[model samples]
Target: MVQFLNENGEFAVASKEHEIYAQFIRDLRESDFLKFYRDMARIRRFDNEATALQRQGQMGLWVPAVGQEGAQIGSGHAVGPNDNIFPSYREHGVAITHGVDLMSIIKMFRGVNHGGWNPYEKKFHLYAIVLGAQTLHAAGYAMGVNFEGKVATGNPEIDEAVITYFGDGATAEGDISEALLMAATTNAPLVFFCQNNQWAISSAVETQTKVPLYRRGEGFGVPGIRVDGNDVLACYAVTKKHMDDARNGLGPYLIEALTYRIGAHTTSDDPSKYRDAEQVAYWQARDPIIRFEKFLRSQGIGQDFFDEVQAAGDQLAAEIRETTFALPEPELELIFDHVYSEPHPLIEEQRAWLRGFEESLGGHTPTDDGENKVDYGGSR
Candidate 1:
């Protein structure tokens, strides 16, 4: 695996093969390090707040990205302004890095909206709930970019690329396989980023695949690389290089980030039932945030900076909690909206049918008493 910072937060070349990736981080300034640390801390705070909101019944569900911050934030920053990002549901850190409002993600889980941000404006697509489906979408988009004569045009500013993020479990999806084939055949300017967080819900990644995920694309003619997902600098370097290569008209590349999921797969899962304490404790010791902090301290960053980040995180938590509580409940008809870009006759017919059904029910809303209320012809 490509790693610049080890578990001890010491920076050294992992191997000669990874030295190329290490070279990319040579020009990074202290300011960049600080920014990375700040974003990672803030996103963890956001993740914690969202989990709490779910527990309090404020959100319908929550997907925590606690341990994968380095992978998300580092690779998120590596994406150029013109590049498009198609994220799986757990990429809250990536969304924030692209300037997506945290409340938009909150509203999604609050059952208020279908990802409130505009993808065209931010170049960050809507979160994909269907596993690995976005890979095909990203492949198509990159192929479109290729056909438009945008790649390898000798103008970096005009070239465009596409990236899709998914998990280890998603690698088993046929959509990902088809996407790889299409990208390779068309030489699409795309990069496949996989955060192998070790568990597919309760299924271990080891049992899910026969080979390392990075090699999964090789048979399709798309080369792959493995990176230390917890090493923020390594992720940034490797992703920046691959993405830049993709934008420069190199065909699709795959990056498998080896990381761990520190929390349950979702708010509804009980990880303790499937995983042991020792495994969790082992990963906890290599916590990305704590490791990065150690690296920063070595560079003369003191307690004051750490304290400031903590204060900022606390303030962020408070602000998002307030925002989530203040969110307005979505109308019952919202499901009918955004089914299509423009109004369609079928949608209108279905919507009208729903409205008629609601009217026939006498506008009676469901109660929270946990009892099934059946409205008979003339009685309850």
Candidate 2:
């Protein structure tokens, strides 16, 4: 794996030896570094809270991106405003980086909304629950951008790129392969970012592929590289380079981020059932947040700074919890609202039948205020 920072939280190279990757790091101000840390810390806090909410039955399901924060944050920060991002279900960090409202994400898991936020407004698509589905969407969008003569425009500001994120397990899906073929053949300005977090649910990476995931991209004629997904600096540098190349009309690229899935695949999963304790311990020792904190300390960042960030993360978690609880229960009629842009006769008829049935029930009816009223043999 390409690693700029080792597990010991020390740089593998001196400052002067940054070489080609220098452009990505050199221009970064202190605020940028702190922002990366803040983003990761805040998302992890939110992830923990969301998991708790799932256990308490607030959400139907929750996917935790616990250990892979570095990969998501670094790559997310690398993208420009002109770029679009298509994310799989677990990309909370990326969504947050792209200015997505955290409550909207929570609303999605709570089953109260179908992706509550508008994708166009943030240039970030709704999370795709189906494995590898968003890859196809991203490729199609990139192809459309090319068709519009947006590629090779010389002006970096005008040329756009597309980035789609998926996990290692998604690579086994036929949709991913087809997306790769489309991107390569069409030379679409796309970057396929695969966060190879070692495990696909309970299946290990060894079971999923005979060789490294990055190598698969090469067979499809797309240039691919592996990066230490736990090293934010490396992830940022590598993704920035490829994104820049893609925008310049050099075609698509693939990045296999070698990280670990520190938590259960979802709230319903039990990682302890399939994985050994030693493996978990090994990854826990290489925790991205811990390593990054060490680097910050080495750079003379004080304990006071870390404390302030902790407080901020705590505040964010509290606010998210409040907002999540405050979200109004989705009305039963909402399911019919977005089924079709233009109303269909069959749908309207079914909706009317349902409304009448509810009204027929003595204790159930629509109130004058337009809210549903339900009483179980009790006075209203």
Summarize candidate 2's per-residue lDDT along 1-380 as a digit string, tens digits: 66777887787644554556657877788888889898999899999999988888889999999999999999999998999999999999999888998888899989998785889998999899899999999999999999998888998779999999999899999999999999999999999999999999899988878878988788788988888899888888888988999999999999999999999999999999999999999999998888888988898889999999999988987898888888888775786677888756566566666676777785345433533344333231
Which residue pairs in candidate 1 collide? none
Show the lowest summed lDDT stretch of 10 residues, model 2: 371-380
RMSD of 1: 6.1
TM-scores across all candidates? 0.92, 0.93
The pairs that clash in candidate 2 are none
- Candidate 1: Cα lDDT at 34: 94
The candidate that wins on lDDT is 1
Q: Name the TM-score of candidate 2.
A: 0.93
Q: Please give the lDDT score at residue 109 for candidate 1.
A: 88
Which regions in candidate 1 have their CA more than 4 angstroms from the true location? 349-380
